[model samples]
Target: MDKKDLRIVFMGTPDFAVASLRVLVENNYNVVGVITMPDKPSGRGHKIQHSAVKQYALEQNLPILQPEKLKNENFIEELKTLRADLQIVVAFRMLPEVIWDMPRLGTFNLHASLLPQYRGAAPINWAIINGEKETGATTFFLTHEIDTGKIIAQERIPIGESDNVGKIHDELMNMGAKLVQKTVDLLLEDKVDAIPQEQFFNNEADLKSAPKIFKETCRIDWNKPVEQIYNHIRGLSPYPVAWTELYTIGEEPIAAKIYSANKIQTEGQLPVGSISTDNKTYLQIACMGGAIEVKEIQLPGKKAMKIDELLRGYKFQEGSYFK
Candidate 1:
């Protein structure tokens, strides 16, 4: 079958999914329709906001569907009318069997992590939080199980010691775009040999899960080793950032989000959560083994700024600490 002859229905909602859809459209693939989340009220104004995929699909002049209820008979009928031969999912919600099973060639998803590991909603965040030295993107056939279907292609990416979630996300977004195209190409030529994720593991205990991260999960624990704490900060940097409570003797505790930090690597340490700053360019917090040098931070009601800039406007008095 010609690559351009395969009618594809692409399902995605976020910017991550837009990359793959863009690649398919740019390559002149036959993407018959796009399905994204319904627009929702956002921000203080509560204005309706279209999903990233929806916005991009509009620019590309692709047909779009934003079904609030996937099981609605009307939605099912509309989807069937598209007459898609194949379906592609990326960063989208789970599909009922009725929808996934409708396509003749079946549905495939592009996941952020290697299969059998990080097989959940937030793979990129957990991989960085766990301090893994490497991770990758995978394209797989979707079945009854989520992220556990047969794999078609994968591309590995190295995680730098200082790399944050944002950096890794961008890298994988581009890599996933190419891999999605490759998966489609292989399917067109009938060259794909799907591999089950079970073949990679002998026991379930060996797998590392990528569960959803909540706000509590992003709180910084001062008792952990300096390296772990450093990893925690970077892993969540620039979004749902790692945070700590700054307590002053006479004032309410302030929530401070830490964005950029590094381990000081000292042999001796003060009490955990101890704060030492020159009132100029640096803020160091003591931990179990050493301390972390906080370079960028944001206090409540303030934008994220460098330690020096924050120092000029705000002061951490003597004996103040982060709890």
Candidate 2:
């Protein structure tokens, strides 16, 4: 069937997922229905927050399915009734064989990173934290394995020196939307081949995976090199920022949220976890090899501000050490 005529069942949840979903809607593709995560409590008031995909689907008045279990007999039966010509899975959860295999055209997914590399939940965060010079997005058929489907198309984007996860996410989101359109067009025209990743051969470079992140994973490690530490802070920045607590005289322990930092010279006289500052224009903390200048930071119960702004209120003695 022609792609425009193909009945597409779109699946995904977050803003990332919405990009592709929007592309299909704007292009007038036959997006017969949508599958997204159910609304869950969010924010201080605990009011329900709907998924971005769900919101978009409602605006377009598309059919939506938010089943808690894809494996349920009734859910699977309902999915089969759509008779989707092709299934497109974006930033969504895994599908059971009963559902993913139900579509005649087979299901495909848009992953945040180059497949076989960064193949798990937090691909964008992991790529930035690892200081990768290049990363890209991929759309591939969905097989039994997670993010291991056959390759359909790929788009490479540069990761800059000052790049963080948040910046990369925006860039990729736009790129993903465009790529999705191209993929669908080619898919309908039968101009693209869906080949297993293993067909082209494989190596160590192809085995990277993305694992879930947690609070423990966001802690700053002073023992690591300054570059890695700095990347970690920025990679998780403006989100679950890499944080540490500090103790000062005549005050309660304060949390430091590092959004930006740079390497600086330190005599290493102070041990790791030590802090020394000029008390005016600079704040530097010791790392494994050198010190990282706190270019941007936020303390507990305060807004994120530059070093100079924070220094104004958080005065430290010339020799006072941080724990």
> What would the per-residue lDDT of candidate 2 be over residues 164-275, giving only the tens digit for each residue?
8889999999999888888888888888788787775557565766799898898888888878888898789777788877766666777778888877655563577777
Candidate 1 regions with alpha-carbon error over 4 angstroms: none
**What lDDT would each prediction earn against the true structure?**
0.94, 0.85
Per residue, candidate 1 scores C-alpha lDDT tens digits across 21-44 of: 999999999999999999999999
Per-residue error for 141 in candidate 1, Å, reads: 0.9
Per-candidate Cα RMSD to the true structure, in Å, reads: 0.8, 2.2
Worst 10 residues of 2 by lDDT: 314-323
Q: Give the range where candidate 1 is weakest over 10 consecutive residues by summed lDDT.
A: 260-269
| Candidate 1 root-mean-square deviation in Å | 0.8
> Highest lDDT among the candidates is held by which one?
1
lDDT of 2 at 63: 97
